[model samples]
Structure formats: C-alpha cells, structure tokens
Target: MFEIGDKIVYPMHGAGTIKAIEEKELAGQTQEYYVINMKIGDMQVMIPASKIVSSCIRPITDIRALKQLIHNFHHGESDEVLPWKQRYKVNSEKIKTGEIQDCAEVVRDLLRMNKEKTLNSSEKKMLDHAYKFLNSELESIKGITDNQIKSFS
Candidate 1:
C-alpha cells in the first residue's frame, strides 16, 4: 500500500524510501514489487506487494509515538542481570527482527547496563547500531538534527 517516495522502516534494515513500483515476470507470472532504497546507506530492496504486510515494513513513528519511545528509554525498568552471552543473544535477535519497540528495549537495557559497567566491544557495537537506527527515525519524525536527538540520550 506504499507509494513511490514514501519513507518506510524495513526491519533490521533501518529506514528506506520507496523508489519505484514495477511489474516484473517471476515464475512465469507477472508480479508487482516495491523497490526500496535505504536511507542510511546505499542499498536497494525489492519487496513483493503481497508480502508487504507480513514483512513488518512500516512508516516512521509520529512525534507522540517517538516521545513515548523516548520516555520508555528514560524510564523503562532494567533487565535482570544475566550472563553477557545470553543477553547478547536476546538483544541480537531483537535487532535483527527490526521491531522498533523491541529495539528500543534493547537500547534501554544496554544503556542501563553501560551505566553500571563497561560493555564488551560487541555489545558496544550493537548499542551503537541500535542507537543509530532509532535516532534516524526519531530525527526524521521530529524534524530535528541528530544532535538534538542525542541530547535525549
């Protein structure tokens, strides 16, 4: 249901712009696909229309929703202390699945952990990636600079 030029978030892939809609022959049948060009990097993705809904692709959050996420980041409870390996596994899956709320949870959890102790290199990278992805959408939604968003950190 997305039109050309619409901005959408692709799970794990961050935000992207719908570059075009085209029909192509596949498996002896013609099908339509949305060509999405990533906003954060140089990459294009083709998604079948039928699969769009199931794919979890969605528009950027509104200001209110973004604020709620920020509030969650600021006030959310911490995860119980777990083995780093196990925590990394859970957080990694949340990032890969590209669910915004889940990613927020990971960010909140990691931030809390970082506040308590130093994170391993891998954990630091995951935290950075999650921050980048969330910050991009939040900046766009608020029409603010990345620095402004960083002030919320």
Candidate 2:
C-alpha cells in the first residue's frame, strides 16, 4: 500500500503522487481512496484501495531498473513484424501494463518504425502517448527537466 507523498504510476495515465487518502461513500458503501495528483496535464485521479491491484497502480521505478531500461533502448532492436492491426493491439496492451520497460519497448519500436517510414496516424499517436508516459516517470525518478529528456532519446 502507498502512503501520502509516495509517487506512483497509474497505467496509461502517467505518474503522480499520493496527495491524500480519503474515505468517501459511493454506491452505498464507504471506501478508502488514494487521491493522486498527476505530474502531467495538471490532473488528479482517485483510485480505490480495494481496486488498487486490478487498477495497476504501482510505485515509481528504482534507478537500477531505469538504467537497465536505458540500456535496452540503446542496444536492443525491435522485431515487430505483425500487421498494423495486430501490432497496434499488441503495443496497446504493453502500454496498458504501465511497466516502464514495456512502455520503452513500444516507444523504441515505434520510433524505429518512424525512421524507416512514416507511421500511420494511429501509430504516431500511440507513440506519442507511450513516450509521454515513459518520459513522465523518468522525469520524476531522474529529476530531469523536459529539455534533458530529449538527450536520452
């Protein structure tokens, strides 16, 4: 369980801090919720304690994992050969997992594809979203500004 001030990444929504934990009544039940203040978009999200597991809320990654992710991006190659429809489905699933490594893979593959050729509009949008999600987490963990993030790419 996360305490107030703990940073966490909400799947597909980017990273945020636990600003407060509050009890509220909904559907004739009183339940505890984590009030997350998102780092991007000036947004806030309230996730229920009971649903935390299924909601895929997770703590920010450690430095070791971040280093490994950067290594993979620099040294790995993507073998995404599925048709566009199938590839989109798979990439979407990976991004939804909210795993930084998986999200990085999606961004790497999409960026690679873009270099080879222009991606369809949908794929471009997906790439942007995945990159934003991954970069937001990286910024929080690494304490880097947006300008510094580009140097990693």
Name the best candidate (by lDDT): 2
lDDT digits (tens) for residues 1-153 of candidate 2: 899999899998998999999999999999999999998787999988999999989999876675577778878888648899999999999999999889999999998899999999999999989999988898888555565467457
Pairs of residues at least 3 apart in sequence or in different chains that clash in candidate 2: none
Q: Which stretches of candidate 2 lie over 4 Å from their true place?
A: 142-148
> Of the candidates shown, which would achieve the greatest TM-score relative to the real structure?
2
Clash pairs, candidate 1, are 12-98
Span of ten consecutive residues with least summed lDDT in model 2: 143-152
C-alpha lDDT (0 to 100) for residue 90 of candidate 1: 88
RMSD of 1: 2.1
| Clash count, one per candidate | 1, 0
Tens digits of per-residue lDDT for model 1 on 37-69?
886666899999999999989987766666676
